[model samples]
Target: MLDKLAKAGDIIAADAVTRAIAKLSETPVPAGVHVEATEGGVLLSGRHLRRRMLGDPQLRNFGK
Candidate 1:
Protein backbone atom coordinates (compact mmCIF):
# COMPACT_ATOMS: atom_id res chain seq x y z
CA MET A 1 0.00 0.00 0.00
CA LEU A 2 2.28 2.78 1.26
CA ASP A 3 5.29 1.16 -0.31
CA LYS A 4 3.66 1.18 -3.68
CA LEU A 5 2.61 4.77 -3.26
CA ALA A 6 6.16 5.82 -2.38
CA LYS A 7 7.77 3.82 -5.15
CA ALA A 8 5.25 5.20 -7.57
CA GLY A 9 7.82 8.01 -8.15
CA ASP A 10 5.08 10.57 -7.91
CA ILE A 11 6.37 13.53 -5.93
CA ILE A 12 2.93 15.03 -5.43
CA ALA A 13 1.59 11.89 -3.82
CA ALA A 14 4.71 11.44 -1.72
CA ASP A 15 4.59 14.99 -0.46
CA ALA A 16 0.99 14.44 0.52
CA VAL A 17 1.97 11.51 2.66
CA THR A 18 4.82 13.43 4.29
CA ARG A 19 2.58 16.34 5.14
CA ALA A 20 0.02 14.02 6.61
CA ILE A 21 2.63 12.50 8.83
CA ALA A 22 3.74 15.91 10.06
CA LYS A 23 0.20 16.77 11.06
CA LEU A 24 -0.31 13.49 12.81
CA SER A 25 2.79 13.59 15.01
CA GLU A 26 2.22 16.88 16.72
CA THR A 27 2.01 15.47 20.24
CA PRO A 28 2.77 12.34 22.16
CA VAL A 29 2.83 10.11 19.13
CA PRO A 30 0.81 6.93 19.02
CA ALA A 31 2.72 3.70 19.46
CA GLY A 32 2.68 0.35 17.71
CA VAL A 33 2.96 2.02 14.37
CA HIS A 34 5.52 1.77 11.63
CA VAL A 35 6.18 4.39 8.94
CA GLU A 36 8.47 3.39 6.15
CA ALA A 37 9.28 5.39 3.05
CA THR A 38 12.23 5.04 0.79
CA GLU A 39 14.62 7.95 0.29
CA GLY A 40 12.64 10.89 -0.96
CA GLY A 41 13.96 10.73 -4.50
CA VAL A 42 12.30 13.93 -5.59
CA LEU A 43 10.32 15.28 -2.67
CA LEU A 44 12.52 16.07 0.26
CA SER A 45 10.89 16.28 3.71
CA GLY A 46 7.90 18.22 4.82
CA ARG A 47 8.04 16.95 8.34
CA HIS A 48 9.37 20.43 9.14
CA LEU A 49 9.43 19.30 12.72
CA ARG A 50 11.93 20.18 15.38
CA ARG A 51 13.18 17.98 18.17
CA ARG A 52 14.79 19.16 21.42
CA MET A 53 15.03 22.63 19.98
CA LEU A 54 16.85 21.54 16.84
CA GLY A 55 15.14 21.98 13.50
CA ASP A 56 14.76 19.74 10.46
CA PRO A 57 18.07 20.34 8.71
CA GLN A 58 19.97 18.60 11.46
CA LEU A 59 22.13 15.57 10.82
CA ARG A 60 19.29 13.19 11.43
CA ASN A 61 16.70 11.19 9.68
CA PHE A 62 13.52 12.31 11.38
CA GLY A 63 11.30 9.58 10.05
CA LYS A 64 13.61 6.90 11.27
Candidate 2:
Protein backbone atom coordinates (compact mmCIF):
# COMPACT_ATOMS: atom_id res chain seq x y z
CA MET A 1 0.00 0.00 0.00
CA LEU A 2 0.96 3.68 -0.03
CA ASP A 3 1.90 3.63 3.63
CA LYS A 4 4.24 0.69 3.15
CA LEU A 5 5.84 2.40 0.20
CA ALA A 6 6.37 5.55 2.24
CA LYS A 7 8.02 3.62 5.06
CA ALA A 8 10.32 1.90 2.61
CA GLY A 9 11.24 5.23 1.10
CA ASP A 10 12.10 6.67 4.49
CA ILE A 11 14.35 3.72 5.27
CA ILE A 12 16.10 4.07 1.94
CA ALA A 13 16.64 7.75 2.49
CA ALA A 14 18.07 7.20 5.95
CA ASP A 15 20.41 4.52 4.70
CA ALA A 16 21.59 6.74 1.86
CA VAL A 17 22.32 9.56 4.29
CA THR A 18 24.29 7.25 6.54
CA ARG A 19 26.33 5.91 3.65
CA ALA A 20 27.08 9.45 2.47
CA ILE A 21 28.23 10.44 5.92
CA ALA A 22 30.50 7.42 6.15
CA LYS A 23 32.04 8.23 2.80
CA LEU A 24 32.65 11.80 3.87
CA SER A 25 34.37 10.65 7.03
CA GLU A 26 36.62 8.37 5.05
CA THR A 27 38.09 11.30 3.13
CA PRO A 28 41.87 11.74 3.41
CA VAL A 29 43.34 14.76 5.15
CA PRO A 30 46.68 16.19 6.15
CA ALA A 31 48.99 14.22 8.36
CA GLY A 32 48.44 14.44 12.14
CA VAL A 33 44.91 15.58 11.48
CA HIS A 34 42.12 13.82 13.33
CA VAL A 35 38.40 13.50 12.79
CA GLU A 36 35.69 12.86 15.34
CA ALA A 37 31.97 12.64 15.12
CA THR A 38 29.94 15.25 16.97
CA GLU A 39 26.27 15.78 17.65
CA GLY A 40 26.04 18.25 14.78
CA GLY A 41 28.55 16.64 12.40
CA VAL A 42 32.15 15.54 11.99
CA LEU A 43 34.85 17.63 13.62
CA LEU A 44 38.39 17.84 12.24
CA SER A 45 41.27 18.97 14.37
CA GLY A 46 45.01 18.75 14.22
CA ARG A 47 48.29 20.63 14.12
CA HIS A 48 51.08 20.91 11.67
CA LEU A 49 54.16 23.09 11.46
CA ARG A 50 53.88 25.85 8.89
CA ARG A 51 57.37 25.93 7.45
CA ARG A 52 58.09 27.37 4.04
CA MET A 53 59.51 24.04 2.92
CA LEU A 54 56.51 22.17 4.33
CA GLY A 55 53.66 22.93 1.98
CA ASP A 56 50.39 21.19 1.10
CA PRO A 57 51.72 19.88 -2.19
CA GLN A 58 54.84 18.55 -0.54
CA LEU A 59 52.85 16.95 2.19
CA ARG A 60 50.79 15.04 -0.33
CA ASN A 61 53.95 13.84 -1.97
CA PHE A 62 55.10 12.30 1.27
CA GLY A 63 54.26 8.63 2.01
CA LYS A 64 53.82 8.02 -1.68
Candidate 3:
Protein backbone atom coordinates (compact mmCIF):
# COMPACT_ATOMS: atom_id res chain seq x y z
CA MET A 1 0.00 0.00 0.00
CA LEU A 2 2.77 2.45 0.87
CA ASP A 3 4.62 1.52 -2.29
CA LYS A 4 1.54 2.10 -4.40
CA LEU A 5 1.00 5.49 -2.78
CA ALA A 6 4.61 6.47 -3.36
CA LYS A 7 4.35 5.51 -7.02
CA ALA A 8 1.22 7.58 -7.44
CA GLY A 9 2.89 10.56 -5.82
CA ASP A 10 5.87 10.26 -8.12
CA ILE A 11 3.61 10.06 -11.16
CA ILE A 12 1.75 13.18 -10.08
CA ALA A 13 4.99 15.09 -9.50
CA ALA A 14 6.36 14.10 -12.90
CA ASP A 15 3.15 15.12 -14.64
CA ALA A 16 3.18 18.48 -12.92
CA VAL A 17 6.79 19.07 -13.88
CA THR A 18 6.03 18.10 -17.49
CA ARG A 19 3.11 20.49 -17.68
CA ALA A 20 5.20 23.28 -16.13
CA ILE A 21 7.89 22.75 -18.73
CA ALA A 22 5.37 22.88 -21.53
CA LYS A 23 3.94 26.12 -20.20
CA LEU A 24 7.38 27.61 -19.68
CA SER A 25 8.29 26.77 -23.25
CA GLU A 26 5.29 28.76 -24.48
CA THR A 27 6.27 31.89 -22.54
CA PRO A 28 8.48 34.47 -24.16
CA VAL A 29 11.93 35.19 -22.75
CA PRO A 30 14.42 37.99 -23.25
CA ALA A 31 17.15 37.81 -25.88
CA GLY A 32 19.96 36.54 -23.65
CA VAL A 33 17.89 34.25 -21.46
CA HIS A 34 17.86 30.52 -22.10
CA VAL A 35 15.23 27.99 -21.01
CA GLU A 36 15.94 24.31 -20.65
CA ALA A 37 13.93 21.36 -19.39
CA THR A 38 15.49 19.09 -16.77
CA GLU A 39 14.38 15.90 -15.03
CA GLY A 40 13.36 17.81 -11.89
CA GLY A 41 12.26 21.15 -13.36
CA VAL A 42 12.98 23.89 -15.89
CA LEU A 43 16.16 25.93 -15.83
CA LEU A 44 16.49 29.59 -16.80
CA SER A 45 19.87 31.14 -17.39
CA GLY A 46 20.87 34.71 -18.11
CA ARG A 47 23.27 37.39 -16.95
CA HIS A 48 22.06 38.94 -13.69
CA LEU A 49 18.50 38.21 -14.74
CA ARG A 50 17.38 36.42 -11.58
CA ARG A 51 18.03 39.36 -9.30
CA ARG A 52 16.50 41.83 -11.75
CA MET A 53 13.40 39.75 -12.24
CA LEU A 54 12.75 39.19 -8.56
CA GLY A 55 13.18 42.91 -7.96
CA ASP A 56 10.08 43.67 -9.97
CA PRO A 57 6.83 43.33 -8.02
CA GLN A 58 4.77 42.38 -11.08
CA LEU A 59 7.09 39.71 -12.45
CA ARG A 60 7.66 38.31 -8.98
CA ASN A 61 3.95 37.64 -8.63
CA PHE A 62 3.82 35.85 -11.98
CA GLY A 63 3.45 32.42 -10.41
CA LYS A 64 0.52 33.53 -8.30
In terms of lDDT, the best-performing candidate is 3
What is the alpha-carbon RMSD of candidate 3 to the true structure? 2.8
* Global Cα lDDT for candidate 3: 0.71
Candidate 3 residue-wise lDDT at 49: 75
For TM-score, candidate 2 versus 3, the one ahead is: 3
Best-performing candidate as measured by TM-score: 3
Clashing pairs in 3: none
lDDT accuracy of residue 64 in candidate 2: 35
lDDT for model 2 comes to 0.62
| Residues 1-64 of candidate 1: C-alpha lDDT, one tens digit per residue | 6987777768887788777666444423223323343454222333432342263233144344
Model 3 weakest 10-residue run by lDDT: 55-64
Cα distance off (Å), candidate 2, residue 10: 0.5
lDDT of 2 by residue, 1-64 (tens): 6999999999998887676666656667666766565444566666753452256764444323
| Model 3 TM-score (2 dp) | 0.57
Q: Which residue pairs in candidate 2 have backbone atoms (N, alpha carbon, C) closer than 3 angstroms, thus clashing?
A: none
Cα deviation in Å at residue 4, candidate 1? 18
Judge candidate 1 against the unseen true structure and give its global Cα lDDT, from 0 to 1.
0.45
Model 1 vs. true fold: TM: 0.29
The residue-by-residue lDDT of candidate 3 on 1-64, one tens digit each, is 6999999999998888789877875566666767776676667777887785777564354334
